[model samples]
Target: MTEFIPRPDQPASTSRMPSPLVTMIVAGAVLSLCMGLRQSLGLFLQPMRAELGVSASAFGFALALQNLTWGLAQPVIGMFGDRYGPRPVLVVCGFLYSAGLLLMALGGPTIGLNIGAGVLSGVGIAGCGFGLVLGAVSRSVPPEKRVQAVGAVSAVGSLATLVIAPVCQAIIENDGWQAAALSFAAVAATIGVIALFIGGKPAPAKDHSAVASNTRQAVGEAIRHPGFVAMTLAFFACGFQLQFITVHLPTYLGICGVSTEIGAIALGVIGIANAVGSYVTGRLGTRYRPKQLLALIYLLRTVAITAFVWFPVSAFSTLAFAAIMGLLWLGVVPLVSGTVARIFGLQHFNTLFGIVFLSHQIGGFAGAWLGGVSYDLTGSYMTAWVSMALVGLGAFVLQWSMDDRDRPAPGIKDSLLGTS
Candidate 1:
């Protein structure tokens, strides 16, 4: 029943900051580089298995570990961004991301894959990923424009897969997976330079702002809010469905007798649709309740999954499925982040989003790891796919029934009403 109300003293927008367009562009670049490499890892799985003799489960576990690491590190990294600034966090994460890819390329099966892909890249992504970037964008824009700005950044960020996936696949086919990874690492290294233009530091919250006095209170309030709880739990399904497909879809297509090239093309199609979807979702958020839109996305995802699994596999179906999934992909981001901003304000935006994102990563861990485990155990991905669809359905129900009313921060005077 409780939700956060905006502080009256809070500025409608930040002053002396870079133009909103510049900020969103820089944020998109950071996300694109970070997410592009992370999302495209599936392309390396089969080749790695073939060359290094690693089992599917091992690779899955590594990716699961990666997601776990990213989740575990996100809150801490987000806090750092909130207190100091996002710039330093992005720079350091870029280096780590580049190093992780290099190690994955050169380290071979056991050590390289585990440390590079799992721990290092995971940590890298935690800082440079959506939470920090979206928080920065939200802080710079007006309350009314926040969701749209977040959507634009997300849409641009999704475009990375359009170019990265196909290029990586090409490199893998011609040279080797290692070569493709090395190329990814090189691209990742650019993130640090991009960070220079992001922003200097988090703007200080005004004295009369309705925000929590400290990080502890902000996190505590978020945990106690029922809507936040539902959102976090529902995010688990998002992670599960997405991670499973990203890590296993290529392999799944292969089992159905589809060529690897088709899988690559399919991911590219998802990227294209994801951009359009993210932008449209952002625009829709302005006119609709985000919770309802979120529920719809989950429902549609479930339908798409059911159809994909129930029908025959072919190039057309695969591409069409990818497009549907892509349209649904990353759309949750703007909604979830926008909801958080609406409910809590921007004082600790990244930290709060990061906590919620932890649930998503946990689901990602299960989805990625379980998909591989199921395949190894039953020799098919049917169980994992079914499980993902079930989770999405559950998410739809929970999201639909969630309470999204604004709960004012306790002890703050009623006079202190809008966002800081």
Candidate 2:
């Protein structure tokens, strides 16, 4: 019998590495543009509803659909990004996102807010948001540095929120809401072009048996892992709190007789603090275990929410809540993604993590929609705030119970199922 021989062109390394700074910069710029566009949407809610004569629940439903659609599409998008490359996915996402905005601008009244603003925008976000960019970043970075890279990317979005929210408010003031929407569409289109530059390089093919096996095993193993399940559940609460606060906080404040300017400022403060928090967490992740950090962050959020509920409504309290909560906001992104990589290996990080994030978005939909529903039903936002506090505490407990060392490193265990 003749011996089998491997092809000369076969790849030696399983990983496709890029220059760290270059990847980070590209990821940051794209994420910033995407987030800036997203953050600006809150500015439109009141104006859009007023002009269209839609109920708050109708607008809420649209946003809820957007979150739901984005969550549902994440896993599929991750599969494509993992199989092909981030470039094509990013390009497509950019186009979809731009189109979604354009449709929203055009279909302001005819089809109702839910179809255009909710469904289209949600689909667009699924294509262009952190899900795709983080997948690419996860693939490009080394295992040890994956968490920091994710944190860095997440920080860019927070920074964009800080800067862009104010800029958007200014534009709405000067140009009117419609023009601001059009302007945002233009900026979103520009981001698509930038994504072309960042994600243009093709991922090199690999033939490593170990890497292939690990990728194949990752999904099933992660699904069965209690730590991963707990993390996913905890992340749902994080999403719920984040989306509820980001989407409805302005309106909630307005009900309390706060000015629009102050509301926008409160959001901007959160964004700024979030940027700082993400950076600090990312840096700390390099030296510490991310699981403990995640638990602590969630615990802080619990305390923050409780205080916000109990305290009297004042400028100081509002700003303080925004600052403290923002600091804890998105600090989990780096740690969660980093921990996934550490436990499962980078070969299938995108697919596995995408599933986890999908759960987060589901919670986001519930939080955003319920905030409006509860307010409309009771004529107050107290219920939503209380729910957020409860969820935050639950998240802290679930995160604390997760053991980081449950899963063995890739190739160290013979079978993925038997290791546990």
Candidate 3:
């Protein structure tokens, strides 16, 4: 009898899956730090504008630039992560992130702020944010747990928003915005070190099907697929709606005669809700069509926004909206990431997902920049908010139309639990 052995590229990933707990924890921690830093940038706009005498639009443009740059760089960085592993990419980008924060501190409102916070930080986010971390964690697990892995990491990262938003607000309130930025920078510097422990060991292959496919062919197929196009379009709306709210909510609150502190807390609330919702999202994806779940998520978002915008502004309504919107917040991640992974396989997950994320950041750019421009023009965020609600409907429609059939993965179940 001849013994069959797998090659290095297809080594027993399923059997060798390092501790899923470790992957979740470490990747989650990295996401916590990176997301905490990235999402908290909005809290600075008021102080920075007041100190530097720049219009709301100008500050928004800087943030918009950051989104655009992050989107543009993610594919390249993701390719690096796919080829060389995530650790090296994360290690280098961690330094860049720290430097970007420090530059924001040193430069304040100058053009350097755009370069530091927008350009450099955006690039760093591409390397260290969910684009890389989710994939890394997913890679550490067996095929069965891949969706759960991404969801778990996303939930963990969402927890950071719950904790970090208040911290950013508190820091900005007392120690000042620069202090918060500097503190986050210091935290980001530790990500590379932390990445060492996360999802480094892949599980042994559980089956013969865990093969490495050609990255180019995968990319080409995905690009040509209508489902992938729909996925990207929906994700772009996700970016636009999320960034518009994250970056402008503080100012939006002020326009509504509400306190900015409330906005901060709202962000935190959204994070907490998302943390919970994302976990369920992963589980639900296993049992239901991912496209249906995505459509539902966007529909919920649409409902939440429409209700919030139509009602009178009050603390209770705002908080209620936050809680609802938060649930809708990150539920999209696992679905998007898992869908792509399922469609194309994990061999080129980082790059393929990164392309999807690039579409997202383009939406983020418009979302963040437009809120400011709209506010400056009309003295309110009504336009931006309303536009977001409409976009949510479009996303809902697009997601519903996508092909949700699971491709063949030797041991994996092809049909969702509820589907034929």
Candidate 4:
């Protein structure tokens, strides 16, 4: 028998690891279900507020709470996933997601909305969303193939928005908002079931004491890394911009005299285009540096927002804006996740990315809440839109200035599938 050791640059592989194809397929399905249902919640906003007699600010606050909860809960859930495995965590979150949606449907405006939409759904999203899912995917594939794997999952998952948004809109139109909420609950219940097939769990560190010490060191190293700090800060802008648009765009379109159908159509267009963008961006990651690509995304997003708002709103302009925005959308995920893996290796990837994502969710909370406050106070979302663009421009500078060079901790190896 020969002693085997994997180099720090190469991940250890073994027979017990799940097949890459199976891992990808299962991961993609989970993403599609979880993200699709989550994103479509915006469709319930108008009807729920009208019926519940809730102020726009109140409704926005609930959604804002959801983002905040998701962020606050992510690192803890991610730790669970990293330690116990994604399957059980995802299973529990799926049911939580379903229950939250049900509560939102049944619980009156404030209680249901806050507890269901804000708290439970937020925690559910923390478990099933990009940070944990992508971390799982990354560990299942080779470093050279990691970008493509992540991109593919993101692209496939993005397609869910195309169908989910429209379906929810139709349900809201025909069956009422409560029915739409219930439908979302039903869909969410499937996430856990699908998660059963996802593979790749964290390898146990050789010694429990060593693992504890390494984790502390790893967290400190990431915090001290200028690139990680820059990336985390820049991610806030990403959340602020995207969430503001997702939550407010429908209302903005309605204000501009576009039909609700047109708004739904715009969202669908975004979904379709996002698939392409996610895939192309992943391929581009192979050639261009992740930091550069991220900077470009922010710059382009700022331009699109500036142009979309500056010009008068029309169905044509709205859909066109959606196309542009969609193309630039989830493209950020692969780059961000890949950067974490490259810089820190896989040991604490989910937790590290969760920390970065907390910044994003904080921005989400601000963006969603402030959009309502701005509109309520100013009679226009123009102020929020302007703020979003400025923040994005600032993120561009931060991302561009980041140094994303690989600097894994001394004891951390590229523990992909088998190595402990």
Residues 183-205 of candidate 3 have per-residue lDDT tens digits of: 87888789878887654434322
lDDT of 2 by residue, 1-420 (tens): 122121122221324445556667777888877766775576677777677776666666677778888888887887777677777887778777777777777776545356666676676677677776776676665555666778888887777777777777788788777777777777778777877755443354332223445455657778777899899999999889988887788787777777777777888898888888998898788777677788899889988888887878677788899999989988998888877766665556567778898989999999889988998899988898889988888888989888766455444365433453
Q: Scored by Cα lDDT, where does model 3 land?
A: 0.79
Please report the candidate that would top lDDT against the real structure: 1
Q: What is the TM-score of each candidate against the true structure?
A: 0.95, 0.90, 0.90, 0.93
Q: Which ten residues in a row have the lowest lDDT in candidate 3?
A: 1-10
lDDT of 1 by residue, 1-420 (tens): 223333233432456457778889999999987888888999999999999898788999999999999999999999998887888899999999899989998997887889999999999999889988998898887777778889999999989898999999999999999899899999989998998898778567543334467889888878878999999999999999999989999999999999999999988888889999999999888778888899999999999999999999998999999999999999999999988888777788889999999999999999999999999999999999899889999999999999887775564434465434
Which of the two candidates, 3 or 4, achieves a greater TM-score against the reference? 4
Backbone clashes (count) for model 3: 12
- lDDT winner between candidates 2 and 3: 3
Name the regions of candidate 4 deviating beyond 4 angstroms: 1-8, 12-16, 204-212, 408-420
- Go through the candidates in order and give each one's C-alpha lDDT: 0.88, 0.75, 0.79, 0.84
Which one wins on TM-score? 1
Per-residue lDDT value at 304 in model 2: 88
Return the TM-score for candidate 4, rounded to 2 decimals: 0.93
**Superposed Cα deviation of residue 45, candidate 2 (Å):** 2.0
lDDT value, residue 410 of candidate 3: 31
Tell me how far the alpha carbon of residue 273 in candidate 2 is from the true structure, in angstroms, after superposition.
Answer: 1.1
Model 3 vs. true fold: TM: 0.90
How well does model 1 score by local distance difference test?
0.88
